[model samples]
Every structure is written in structure tokens, then in C-alpha cells.
Target chain A: MKKGKAHVLKIFDNVNTDYIISGRYKFKIANMKDLAKYIFEDIEPGFYKKISKGDYIVAGENFGCGSSREQAPWAIKEAGISAVIAKSFARIFFRNAFNIGLCVVSCDTSSIKNGDVIKLDLKDELVINISRGERIKTMPIPQLMRKFLDDGGVIGHFKKYGDFKI
Target chain B: MGKTIAEKILSSHAGTELKAGDIAICKVDFCFGQDGTSSLIIDSFKKSGRKKVFSPSKFCMVIDHSAPSPNVGVSEIHKKMRDFARSEKVGLYDIGEGVCHVVIPERGHVRPGSLILGADSHTCTYGALNALSTGVGSTDLAMTLISGKNWFRVPESVKITVNGILRKGVYSKDVALRIIGDLGANGCTYNSVEFYGPVIRRLSVEARLTISNMAVEMGAKFGVMEADAKVAAYLNENAKINKGIEGVTADKDAKYVKIKGYDISSLEPLVAKPHAVDNVAPAMDLSSIRIDEAFIGTCTNGRLEDLKIVSEILKNRKIHKRVRCIIAPASKRIFSEAVKRGYIKTFIDAGCVVVSPGCGPCVGTHEGILANGEVAISSANRNFKGRMGNPDSFIYLASPATVCASALEGKISDPRNHIRV
Candidate 1:
């Protein structure tokens, strides 16, 4: 069971992977940490300076919709984002986040406004908006994904066990 | 209850009876990675403590994205890929070979009823040959490289049927954009979409590839079409594989989560507006939108047929002086074919620049990057913000015919006005 206050940084719908990290920087910077500085640079300039470590990014539907570039998730995680809460996530981005151990929660994020502090309970699959005094339910994480997160991503799981336990 | 094509393929690959929503570990028939994702794939493969690829022959590495080294940083990555490919003795498609999606299928690596995976999202393009193919992350691809297998959750199926003959100048790219517009960005999230009907059967294999390549835009896991005589003939003529020519099809009573139909007889050329692939409108409606560039290339519309269409439109006329028209064939084979057909000469006569066979500007790495406040009419997939390197610039998606027509008019124009029915 884990619970914490997540500071919200809101964005609009259909935020594609290209906006998260521009394709120009994908091969230009091989290091994930260096790539983190350009997160949301295209859509939201200076986005890297707006948030602190452990902050949560709340967005509308269809988040990370374009490109299977894993650098998008890597940059977001390296930028110190704790999780990405949205109404829904694109298929490839959803899978990539889990593979990298980045938390992606799906729920009704309409009522949660920007800059609101929300309480996220991972075990309960609940998001309590402390500012709005509202409770929202998120889709349950699959058992295998939960295990992957517990092991700190697929790489860590591979290190712990020679092969995937699946 | 009958099973869909996806279920049939996955169950056979898994060696067990599996249904939609079931998670199973299945053997991959073929897997690949490109320069954009291979670095991470290599890192993960090494970190996993694997010494050799599970099946070096079954795996391949391609250097299409950022090919020929656009910068020093990218050059180092290309060198790394070359070194790794040599060390592992795995197959590698060097720069100028073409985009992975186009080269792999052209070289006969794809077959019907086979399960394939690649590190690039457009990997679903192989599904046009009736294979079960989808994209994966670097780590997932790395795991497949080490184990020769991966896990999957069989996705529910969506049946999209298109009937009636398409109108003149409305190519498969227009059909794809129309369907994607109707489905929205995440309409089929995590679902496998199967295209059917007479229109699909009549389309050439290259046209089908265009439709399947954009399936990822609608959030579909796999976009597949039924294998027919055309696919068999293509494989026989290209790869010489005669066995397993008859591919799998959905059962008569197969279940589908959704069924949608479109009559393309009345369809007109369409274009997806700036920043979103689903923000589609008629080409003529956006004629006022001026452009700085007109690009015709990428896995979506860089084949010989597409180049021929552009050449036919630009045969006796020079493009607008204000527009920079660029054309690239999807592969070196297509390049030579275009040259032999005199299409390359026609493009040059029309003042269009022809680059090498590869993903030139589609990925925003090289060839043509839009400047600030510039607008481009392109035949490539995805018009996401900053997709062509300049966030302040705009990109509109259309067919090669429409792209050529707009290059002549210096703005978005209807292809019907430029071509004869």
C-alpha cells in the first residue's frame, strides 16, 4: 500500500510522443538524462523547469498518441515525473511506460484541475483530489504489470530472474 | 463461437487454444530493429547478460532513421549498430537500403500467418500480407532478441469493411485518413482491426501496405487484411516462397467488438490538418492553406506506384516557385525502378529534388526540415506537432497525388483537378 500527495501539472488531449520529446533530440542526445531537459519543449517550452521531483502529470484523453519511441517515456521518467494520470493512454505508450517502470494511471481526470494536489493510493486504485475533495477510481493494473512495477521495470525483473516469469 | 484471424494466428503461434483477452507467450517468426530504437535495444540486450542473439538469422538491424549520419552524435550511434551487427553476425540493412517497413517486406522476410515484431510502430505494415505483426518497446524487443519469444495479450477484433470503387485521385492514403478520422486517435485502443470487403480485395499489395501502416494512428495493436491471390503472387515473384500461400482468415461467425462500413465510391481526396492525424477535411476545403514545402516519401507513399502518380501530375508543368518539392522512393529497388521508368527525370524536369531511398524527412532527422511559420503538404504518416523538426511549423497529410497537385498550386488543392479520371 502506497499513498502520497501528487502535485498536478495539467495538459490537453492527444499529447503525442513527438510533443513529449521532439524527434530531433531523439538521436541527438543518446543519454536519457540529457534528453530529459527537452521534455515538452515543443508544446510547452521550459516544461522541465516547471516541475519538481515526484510531481504527477495529469492530462486528458489519448496521451502519448504518436510514435513508439521509448525515448518519450524515458525522458518523462528522467525528468522526475512520478506518474502520468490521464483519461486514457495510447497503446504503445502504455506498454512502454510499464516496461520502463513509469506509473501511468487512467481515470476521470476532468474534475482535477491544474496545480491541484491529489492523493494517489496505488493499492486501492483510488485518486483523491484533496483540493476538490473528490474521489476517482482508476482502472486496475494487471497482475503482471503490478509485478513488473514491483520489480522496478522489465530490466530489473530480467536481472532478478534469468527469464520472464510469464 | 468462431475465432477471429488474430485469435487463430496467436493460438497457432502459442501452440495452444487462446482467445481474445488471454495472455500467452508466443514464438515470433521474425523480429527487427531500426537505428532510432536499436541503441536502447542493444543496451537492454547487453544488460540482460545475453551473449548471443537467440536466432541471429531471424533477427535484423536497419539503419534508416537518421541514415548516413546527419550529425556527429548520430554517426556514433550508426557506428555502434554496425559494430554490434558485425559482432553478432546478424543481418543488417545499411544506409540507403530504405525504411525498415518497406525493405523487410520487399526482401521477402514477411509471410502470411506468421507472427512478426519490430521496434518501430509502423511494423504493422507487414500485416498487409496477412501476418500478425505489431510494434514493441526497446526492452520488449531486446527480450525477444535474447529469448526468440515474447508475451502478448490477444486483442479483441474490430472489422472495418469498405465497399465500392474509389473515385479518381482518391488513393489508399485518402482511404486511410478517412478511416482514421472516423475512428479518432484512440478509438480502437488495444484492439486488432481487420479490413474487409470488395474494395480491399481490389487494392494492390502496395496500396494495402499504405492502409496497414497508419493503423497505429488509431491506436490499434494490429491492422491486418485477408491474404489473397495477389499476396501469394507477390511473394512468389519476390521471395519465391510457395508453401503456406493460403493464409488464415476469420471464421464465418467470428466475433468482433465493432463493425464499421464505408462506401468509398463517393469519397474525395482528404487531408489531415496540422498537429493531429484525425483532424481531417476535404482537400479542396483547405485550398487556402499555403505551403512552403511539398514532400512525397516515407513508408506510407514512397513506392513506385506513388512516384508514378506524382510524375504523371508534374509531367509538363513546373512546381510553384515558392514551394520546395522533394520526392524519395521507399527503397533502392524502387529508386532504380523509378529511374528506369523515367519518373525521376520527370520529377527533375518539374523542379523537384529527388533524394536517396530512405526515410528522409518523415522522421525529421534530415533531407527537409521546415522552418519557423512554414507549412508543408506531405504524403507521410503522422502530422504531430514538431514532427518535421520545427514546432512552429505546420504539416498537412495527404496522398501523393494531392501533394503533387498542391506543389503546383502552392497551396492545398484537390488532386481531381490535376489528374484525368
Candidate 2:
């Protein structure tokens, strides 16, 4: 298991997933290893190859503002990134992140900037800046999402908590 | 102070007694979800610790917007939704069936007089049939899953009565774009829009859909029409549509917020300038803005009729060699019909890309997105930044006529003059 942490390299106001991953390659790549190759291939050039799992994405208002594509956050999690820190998320994106156990927090986006290394403790919703010794957040994960996080995504969550009535 | 139909519906379904500042928690009669958002919605269904769905099985999920799963991450999400729907015994789900909006109405879930809510903002597209539909966030949707209720500030009604016969080349999409541009994008926020008058009445049900589907662009909850004999006729013939449906009608003396009237009988094709749906002008007013693509599809105006309108226009003229033209039908049924009618041949003969149904270029995800510095005029909803492709790409909201004529000239030209002789 990886601790949620990452050093930010660039900050954006509202970074939609189409630019992060895109619908063009949706069918071309069918798994994490293959999909990761083109991550931000166009938008933030070199971002997909450079980012490691457990890194953090900080953004301004309405991050993930377009169509409700779960792949937006799914790609982030599978690419080894751990969490997203934003001022506020589009209503759908917030729940989608939690559905698959991705660590997402709403913080004052203006307080953070590029090159800030932060530690994310999912249990308490505490986002600790290792370098600046500052913290910011307000993510109260519902009991259900916690189960998904504990088991590691929906498949794990269901396998562990599923009711086999069928 | 005659009230619009939209006000009548919202007031009737308001659950409890409504007041000026009240944000009533209205019980939802319908809910829609798409593949782009369905997996997570289903996941939240399991995570909410809820045991079963509170809404009826008519609550649907459309596999539009990346239906084929643009990537592996998307595939996993789709699989999760399928497994959840099966395990939960959820009915009314579209498994790569078609675009959410097109499929929802095709399956007969939409009816005049019901207040429906979808996770996609464009959910209001159902208003074409005169239903009051709105879009909400997934969290609010989760609450709906648990309790079958959604909250909303009772919106004021904007009654727009049209008293003109549509010009031969003009379309319902052109009328909607003109209204949205005239009213400004946020002009109708938290408001209900009711289309009435002879023009609205005369529009074919498909044409009415073209108008109502773009309600979101005006920041409205819905663009609805009264459930008249025409609607009843449509429902009766559309296979098994939502039956036993009750309709919402205006109180004889219902209070109104605004009563705007238009005589668009002489109106020309319209366009919404870049970054704003309200920055509109007649297509004839601007001819210099060249385009790279002309798109006519999506839930807004992607039905067979909309296609026929375009094919009739494109059949006479060749597409500009410098520009690309794309028309994505809203459903497989529409696709098959167009093929049977030789409509697809007309489009292909004119050098247009006829994509399979599912939200293609309209959403900037697939189909015909514009590149940087490129411009496009579409019949689809939304002209938001980077909505079509590159953030640098400029998207103008327009009617199907504008899209077709523009495709022929490689510029945003006037479709009114291009009327087939």
C-alpha cells in the first residue's frame, strides 16, 4: 500500500480530464499500463511519464468541470497518483473520486502552488505540506467510500462486502 | 399574468407548499445517468450504504460519452456499472444501447408533465416532450438514490410565445440558438422556459426536441411544451413509451415572471459567438469566420428528422475541400433509418463523416473535435472553453442549417439563403 503524497509541479485553475487523458485513446488502450503512456500527452506534455503514484494534484474551482467521465479520476489513480486537492470539485467528480477510493480533498486552492510537496492522510482528511508545515482540507469520507478505500477500489470493496443473494 | 407551462409543472410537483425563497425537496419521478458518470453513480449506490433504489426502474443509464470506453480505465468503470446494475436488479439501463438522452426518450421514459432529473446538465434535453427535467450533481443524485428526492429553488417561469411560421431553411435548433443568444447564457438560470404559440405548436415532435434539448445552454431547468394531442400521438406510436403518465398543467391564474413574445417568421439562421452562448447574431451578419468542421448531432438535434433536414441541404452542394463535415445520429435506430432512406449516402456523397451514435465531437471527446485555432459551429449543446477539442478551438452554437451551410462554404455562412430550391 502506498501512502498518499506528491510534489506538485504545476498548478491549474480547472484541469478537465479530456486534456488529462482524453476520449480519443479510450478504446485504443484498455488497461493502466497502456493508458498511462498518453496521460496528459497533449495538455501538460511529459506529465503522464513524469508523475508517480502517491503524487497530488491541486486545482482551483470546478476541477473536472465537463462531462461526467469516471475515467478522469480513474486514470489519475491508475497512473500512481494518490490524491487531488482543489478549491471545490464539480458535484459529480467529487463522488466519482470516492467511488473508487481515490483520495480527493477540497481546500483553499489559492493557499498552495506548484512545487509544494504534500502528505495526504486519508483517514483524517489531513493534507500536510511536508516542506511548508501547512495543512488544509475538508473531506469527510462517507462510511461507504471508506470501505472502498480500505479494500482498494470497487472490485476489492465488493469482493469483501458483497451480499451474495444472487 | 398568464403563466408558462414550465412554471405550472414546477409548482405542481413542488412536494410541499412553495414560497418565494424556498428550495423545495421535490421527489424525483425520473433520473438519468450516462456511462461517463454511471459507473460512479452505481458505485456510490453501493457506497451510500443504501440497500435498494428508491426511484422506479425507469431510472436509466445511457452509455454515451465514451461508450466504447476510450481507454482501459474507462473499461473497468463500465464493467463495474454492469456488475452493479445486474446485482442490484436495476432495470432501464442501456448497455452500450445508445446515447443517454436519445436512448431515454427512445425507450419512452420521458413524458410531458413529469419532473425528471439527470446527472448530466443536458438532462433538460428531455423537455422537448414537455417534461420538466434538470441536471444535478452526483452527491445530490446519491441522496435521490437513498430517498428518491431532489432539492431545487422553485424557478421563475419565462414564457416565450412564438407567433411565426418557420422559414423553409430555418430549424428549431436555429430558433433555440437565437433565443439563447438573445437571453444570454445565464438569463434563465434557475428558471423554467415554456415554448408556446403557433410556431412551437407547428414544430414536429423531433423539431420540438431540437428546441427543448438546448435548454441547458440558457441555464434553464427545461424548455417544455404542453402535452397536447401531438405529444399523445407521438407517445402512442413510439412503441411502448412511458404509459399511465400524469401531466402538469398551469393554474388558470398562475402567476408569471416574464412574458416574452417573438415573431421569428422572418428570422434568419443564428450563431452564438465564442465562449458564450448569448453572444449571438444572425448567421448572415458574420460571413468571414471560417470553420474547420460543421457538426450536426447530439441529443439536441440528432434525430432522423434533423438528419433529413441536413441531408436535403448537403445533397445539393459539395462540402468545402478545406473544411470537414460530420453528422452523428442520436441512436442506432436513427442510423439504420437514415441508411434505409439513403440519407447517409447523401452525406457521404457530400464528403461528411457519419459517426455512430454516442456523444462524439459535440463533447470534444470523440468524433469531430476542433484543433487549436480551429472554429466549429454545431447543433450540439454547449460552447464552453475547450468544449470541442483544444482550449484554443472556438465553438459557436448554431442551428443544423448553419452547421450544414457553413460546412459547404468552409465558413459560418447563412443557411437561410441555402434553402433547397
Candidate 3:
């Protein structure tokens, strides 16, 4: 996996899987590699070839909008991406990522830039600009939640927590 | 301290008695929209010139209806809606992320006890988690965007006591369709229906959702069952299922707005002929009209369990090659679950073409659009002509078993023939 300070290249507000992996590729998703080829096909058809694993995706407003299909996040997470930083998340995608243990953070990522070396601290709830020495006012994750994420999302968290206390 | 769930919820939130037909204003926990309606609703909100929305930013918008567009026009519409939502700083969900309801709950936005409102009629599905959620019209949606509150006619309660266990090859959809068939499309106009009985508790969340989501189809303001252990179990394992909003129940001696009972033990697969939800009858009685295509997905019945039931039935069988069977999940959660569980592989192996989630063939817009004179048996909510495309395509409504069996035989065969209770 490529490693570096997470530098976001773009922030698509409402990029959906139809754009990521269009229906045209439906018959072609025999594996992850094939699925990655079509991610954001509607937005910037060949953009995946330019993305790096350490690169961040800072989306505006409700970043991962649309159906509860895990394919959208599956394609995103499987594409070697480290994390998706968004302003907010749809109810389902947010939980799905948490459940699948995908690293997704919600913060004011609107101003974060392409190639900016940003450090996301899940514990302190900070997206620090290591290069610029700037700190973003990221929403703090509750201790219980931080613990949940640290354990690698809801499923793993559940595995650790065992039975849920409703 | 001595009240019911609905009353407790309304009192805690609205700080009032919350009687039937009385309107109350409370902060919304969640809101929903999609490509087709989101743009219009947002535009309407902008037109209202409202400064702040009534609810939190936890509102959602999904692009399910016109997803993977059948035409460039629909795509353009989705684009415009997305652009507007982005500009307004509202959530803009595009196609393939997941359907609104399924995605919302998965993401933790639809926690239990939270009140929800969606632009789509099936918004009532959120009630499955104990949220006092329901659907509203475009104008009302605009108002909610501005004020976060809508006037509601707290419907007089109607108790539908469903007794007797359903026979094998039958499901909650059949029970719901049976109720719809009995109550007609407009049977319980502006009333709340509470399902009660021994068998009602046995139904899964999917089944309950299947029942409550169709409340709109029958002109019900809302359909609920007493929040019980199953609900607690779901919330315990699933989303943040809280000691959710409680509500009023019919008095033991109090008169009901309406009361209906169904033995349902001997009910047959129903086919809502065409145009209207109440235009229904026994599926076996329906003419074995040759079908061009069949669909088994929609917000109404696109869940994994719905497909699982059908997959189990079709295990040793095959869909007639002459007829196409399209199955689309309602949300990505269900789709992915089906995949992880190998149900999708099972379905494909059985010759059924699985598609992405959303309102596909059920809306007649795209994905498995039927041609002229084609007949289809589906687990979807409606059977209006031109619904599955091709005005001449006759559509029959049935449970998954009926649809699967009919798909196997290339004729409308009752699911009962394949099993014994």
C-alpha cells in the first residue's frame, strides 16, 4: 500500500457508484481489479489511474449519498484508498463503512485541498495539516465511537463488544 | 409516565396530547429525498426563501428512481438535482450509493426513536425501527425544508388483528396484499392501522417493513405494530434501536376507527390486475397469460430475505429462458448481504438476472422494461399498466414463491403447488 501524509486531490460532493462503476461494468465485476476500473466512470472516466492509495477524498455535504448498496464504498475502499473525508454521510453508507471497518471520517473538509498533507487523528478528532501546521475544527468522535473505529468499525467493534446493549 | 409509545413520543417531542388529527410540530431526526424529487423539493424550499431548515442536516437524498438512467433526460434531471443540493449545502445522494431508507439506517442517520419524513411514500418504512416516520407531498416537503414541521391528522387508530400462522410459501407480503385486497386501495384513508396478533410478532423486520411500507398504497397515514422484543432485538444488533417513540393504542373498551380480521392461513397468491392496488384476486385464478418478463425488487420487497425465500424455492429449478426475471435490491446493504451470503450467486446460477438496487421495473422506468403483450409476476408493490413498461404488458402481483414458481414454469402457477403447509 502506498504511504504518505494523506493528500486529497478533489472533493466531489455527491459522487455515486453509477459514476464510480457504471451499469455498463455490471457484467465485468468478476473481481476487485475490474470493479476499480469503473469507479467514478461518469465523473472523470479515467480518473482512477491518477489516484494514489494515500490520497484523500474530501466530499462536500452528504458525501456518500444514494442507495445503501455497499458497492459504492466497496469500490472506493477496495481501490486502495486510505479514507474518505466528507462533510456528512448518508445514514446507511456511514454505518456500512463502520460495520465493514472502512475508515470514513466526517468533518469540515470543504477547504482541505489537493495534495495537502493532512493528518487525520481519530483519537483526538483532528485533521491536522502537518505540512502547513494548520488544524481543522473536525467534529469530535465520542470516546465510545472512537473506540469503535479504533477497533476497525462496527463489525469488529461488535466482535469485541460482543452483545450490543440496546 | 403512564402512557403508550405514540403518546410518550409525541408528548416528549411535541409536548402535547397528540390526539388523532391534531397537528404537532417537532424537530425532525431525519429527512429524505432523491434525484427526481430532491431538486424539485430543494427548489421549492429555495422559492419559499426559508433561512433555516426545520430539522438537522442529517437529512438525506438518494438517486434510486432514475438510476443508471434509461435516457439522457433522466440523467440530466439527476445532475441538476445533485448540483442544487451541493449548492444548498444539503446532502445529495446519487445512484448506486443505496436507496434512501436502506442507506439511511445503515449509516446511523436513522436511529430508533428519531422521527423521519421522506418525499417518497414508502417513508413509513422507518417506522419498522420505531421512528414515527412517514411520507409527505412535494409542497409539504418544501415546508419541512423551511420549518422542519408538517401538520398531521393524527389518524384514528384501527386494529387489524391478524390471527393464525401463515402457510408455507406465504409471507408478510401476502398478508399485506391480502389486507390491501380486502381494504381496496383507499380503504383506510387517513387512518392509522396497527397490526396485532400472535402471528404478527413472528414476522421479521423485512416482513414488517413490507407490511408498513404498503400502508400508503392503502391510503393509510401510518401502519404500526406494538414495538416488541423483535424490534428491540433488531435495534440491539442493528442501528441504534432506542427505547423508541411510543404511541397511543386503541382502548380496550374504546371504539376503533375500523377493525379487520384475516384468518390468512388459506390465502392464495394475489395478483393486483392493473391500474389499481385493489384490483386484486387469487393468483391461480388469473389467466396463465404468457409473460415477457418478471421483476422481484422494489422498495416494497427488494430486501435480502425476500430474495432468499425465492432463491430457496428456485434452488432446484430454473427461470424459463423465454422469460426474463430481473431482481434488484432496494438498498446496497441488502445487495451486498445477498452477495456475501452467496444468494446472488444462487440467483444468477438459477438464471435470474440480478440488477442494482432502486425502484427499477416496479416503476416501469428502466431495468427489465417489458414489451407489448408481456405479462410479469412480481413481488413489487403495484401492478399499474405501463408500470413495467409496455402498456400492453399485463402485470400480476404475487409473493416471491409465486413469482419464482411462475418464472420456472413460464406460466402463472400458484406457489402452493410447489410446497405443502
Candidate 4:
């Protein structure tokens, strides 16, 4: 069982890749750390400075809806976001997050408030909202994805198994 | 128990019987990346310590986004792609070749019933030819590059059937925007959307490409159409492969999670408002919103057919003096064709700046970045905030005809009032 507490940073629906990291910095800055500084610069200015290493980003439905730019998830992970809790996620963003070892929790984030401290219990598939004393159910992570997360993403899995191991 | 097109394609590629929700490791027919995502793909490939791509002939790269190197950093990234292409013996389309989505099909890399992948979201454009194509992130693409295979959770299917003919001035883009508006942005997430009905049969290949191109905007995994004689002719004429023309189709009793219908005979020209692709409304209704720039190009509406419509409208008239109209052909082949057909000259005479064939001003890298508080209209797929560079600026999405008409009026206007389409 894996458990951790993190403060929530609330956002809205359909937060696209451009909002997470603008296309202007896509080619100009190759370093993930440098790009992290500009995460959510367009939608939420100075977003990187507000979060600590284990903070959670809670968003509405269809988060990360535009573009297949891995940089979007990379920036979020590089900014030290522990997990992104949302009602839903775009297909590519969901796959990319798992590929990069970013924790993406799908649940009803409507009850979660900004700056709320929430505990994620991965083994129980529950989001314990310590601030409000509520325990919400999360979509169970698939066995393959759980394995990918254990190995720190597809690259780590590949390095260990020499194949996708699908 | 019949299989949908996606299930059939994935099952064949995986060499096993499969269904929706089943995870299968399938062989990839073709895979590619663009400049924006190719750098990360290369880095991931290098980090994996993979000495060679799974199949050089089956893979390629395009330098369409931020092409011609906007700055030193981009130039270095292009150099890396070139170097990697040289060493790996994979095909590389440098600056001016065209957008990856357009260039790949014109170069015969796309075919029916094939499973294609790319690092760019609009890669679904090839689904017009009946291929199971979708976009992926850099790491997944790199994994495919190394192993020539990727896993997929077969997506449930959605059947969208359209009846009746599209009215004059109402192009495929309008129909697509209408459907996207109805479905919302996340309506089709993780689903294979199959387009059917009589209306699809009459649309030209380019028009169908326009529709499939925006499927990603609705979050569809694959937006495919049934291949027919037109697709066969296209493959024969362009791809030069005539024998394998019998493309796959869904089973007669194929299951679909949802079915929606549309009749476009009375559908008016549509536009997606700023900051959201699904915020669609009739183009004429938004005439009060003035525009500073008018762009007519991208993977969605940058074909010769689109340019012909723009030329017809802009032939004898100059655009509004205040509006900066930019036109870009989707590929070099389309560029030469437009030049031969005199569309380029008509555009130049109409005071439009015709740039080289590539994804210009679409990705907000260069060519036509918007200023803060400015407004622009384009024929591109997405109208997300800051999509054209400045977050404060606004963007509206429409068809090329609408964009051209709006260019003439310096505001969002209807194409029907400008010309008889």
C-alpha cells in the first residue's frame, strides 16, 4: 500500500497542452526543468512557484485535451506535482502520464477544494480528503499500468525487461 | 458478433482475435514524428540505448513545426533530427517538405487498413483513407521505434452518420465543427469514431481529410471512414499501389457504443469561438467580432481544393487593408500544383502573403503570432487560447471559404454572402 498527503491546486476542465506548456517554449527550451518554470504560465501565471514537491493538482473533466506533446506531462512532473486528480483525461495525456511515471488519478474531483490536503491510498483505490474528512473512490489502476508505475515508466520497464513485456 | 473497423484492424495487426477493452500488443505499420515532438522522441530513443530503429523504412520524421529554425535552440534540434535520420537511415522531411500529415499521405506512406502512429495529434488525418491512425507521446513513439510494436486497449466504437448533401458555402470544416460542438471536447475520448451515411460518400478525399483531422479535437482515438472506389483511385494515382485496394470495413452488425446522426442540407457555415473548439456558432452570427489576421491553411483545410475556394473568392478583390491574410500550402507538392493552377498568383494579386508549404502560424512558432488583445480567424483545427502565440489574443476557427470571406471583411463573415460556393 502506498499513501501520501499533498495540498490540492484546483483547475478547470479542458486544460490543454498549450496551457500546461506553451508552444513558444516547446522548441526554445529543451530542458524539462527550465520548461517546468513556465508550467501553466498562460492559464495560471507563476504556477510553478506555488507548489511544493508533493502537491496535487485537482482538475475538472477532460484535463490535457490538446496536443500529444509529452512536454505537457513532463512539465507537470518536473514541477514536482505528485499527482493529477481529475474526472477524466484525454487519451494521449493519460498514456503519456503513465509513460513518464506521472501519477494520474481519475475520480470525482468536484468535492476537492483548492489548498485542501488529500491523502492518496493507491492500494485501496481511494482519495482520503483529510481536510474535509471524506473518502472518495478512484478508478482502479490496471495491472499493466501499475507495473509500469512500479518500474518508473515504460523506459524503466524496457531497461529492465528488454521489451515492452505486454 | 461482428467486429468494427478498429477491432478488425487491430486484430489483424496483432495476429489474434481481439475486441474492445482487450489489451493487445500489435505491430505498427508506420510511425512518425514532427519537429516539436521528434526531439523528445530522439532523446528517449537515445536514453533507451537502442542502436537502431526497428525498421527504417517504416519510420520517418518531419521538420514542419518551427521549421527553418526560428532560433538557435530550434536549429540545434533540427540538426539533431537530421543527424539521427542520417545515422538510422530513416526518411527525413526537412523544411518546406510540408506538414507531416499531408506529406506522409502524398509520399505514399499511408494506406487503408494499416495501423499508423505519429507524435503529432492530427496524425488521425490519414484515417480518411480508412487507416487506424492515432497520435502518441514521445516515449510511446520511441518504444515503437525500438520494438516495432505497441500495445493498445481497443477502444469502443462510436458511429456518426450524416445524411443529405452539404449546402453551398458549408464545407467539411463546418460539418466537423458542428459535430464537435454537439459531442463536446471530451465526448469521444478513447473511442474509435466511425463516420458513415450518405453525406460522407459525396465528400471529396480532401474534404474527408478535413473531417478526420479534427477528430482529435473531440478526443477520438481514430476517426475512420469506409474506404471505397475513391480511396482506391487515390491510392492508385498518388500512392501508386493498385493491388491492395480492397480496404477493410466494419462488419455488418458491428457494435457501437453510441450512434449520432446529422443532416447538413440546411447547415450554415460554422465557426468555433475563441479558447474552445466546441464553442461553435454560425459564422454570420459573429460578424460583429472584428479580426486582425486571417489565416487559411493547416492539415485541416490546406489542400488544393481549399485554396481553389479561397482563390475563387479573392480572385478579383483585395482583402480588407487592415487584415493581414496569410496563406500556406500544406505540402510542397500542393504548392507546385497551386502554382501551376495560378492560385498562387491570384493570392499574391489579392495581397495575400503566400508562404512556403508547411505548418505556418498553426503551432504559434512563427510566421503569424498574434499580439496581445488582438483577434484573428483561421482555418486550422484548434482555436485554443494562446494557440496562435499570445494568450490574451483570440482565435476563431472556420473553413477556408469563411476565412477568406472574413479576410475580405476584416471580421467574421459568412462565405455564402461573398461567393456562390
Best by lDDT: 4
* Interface root-mean-square deviation, candidate 1: 1.1
> Which regions in candidate 1 have their CA more than 4 angstroms from the true location?
A1-11
Q: How does model 4 score by TM-score?
A: 0.98
**All models: lDDT?**
0.90, 0.70, 0.65, 0.91
* Candidate 1 lDDT over residue span B152-214, tens digit each: 899999999999998789999999999999999888888999999998999999999999999
| Candidate 3 DockQ, CA atoms | 0.01
| Model with the higher TM-score, candidate 1 or 4 | 4
Q: Estimate each model's TM-score.
A: 0.98, 0.73, 0.68, 0.98
Q: What value does the lDDT take at residue B319 in candidate 2? A: 94
lDDT of 4 by residue, B1-421 (tens): 9999999999999999999999999999999999999999999999888788999999999999887777899899999999999999999999999999999988899989999999999989999999999999999999999999998999999999999888889899999999999999988999999999888999999899999999999999999999999888888877797876578899989999999999888999999998899999999899899999999989999999999999999998999999999999999989999999999999999999998888899889899999889999999998888898889999999999999999999899999999953
| Per-residue alpha-carbon lDDT of candidate 2 for residues B37-113, written as tens digits (9 for 90 to 100) | 56557756766676777754746666777656555766776777677667766654443456677777777777877
Clashing pairs in 2: A5-A54, A6-A55, A26-B70, A26-B71, A27-B70, A30-B72, A53-A80
List A-chain TM-scores for all predictions.
0.92, 0.82, 0.78, 0.93
Give the candidate order by descending DockQ: 4, 1, 2, 3
lDDT of 3 at B324: 92
Model 3: CAPRI class = incorrect
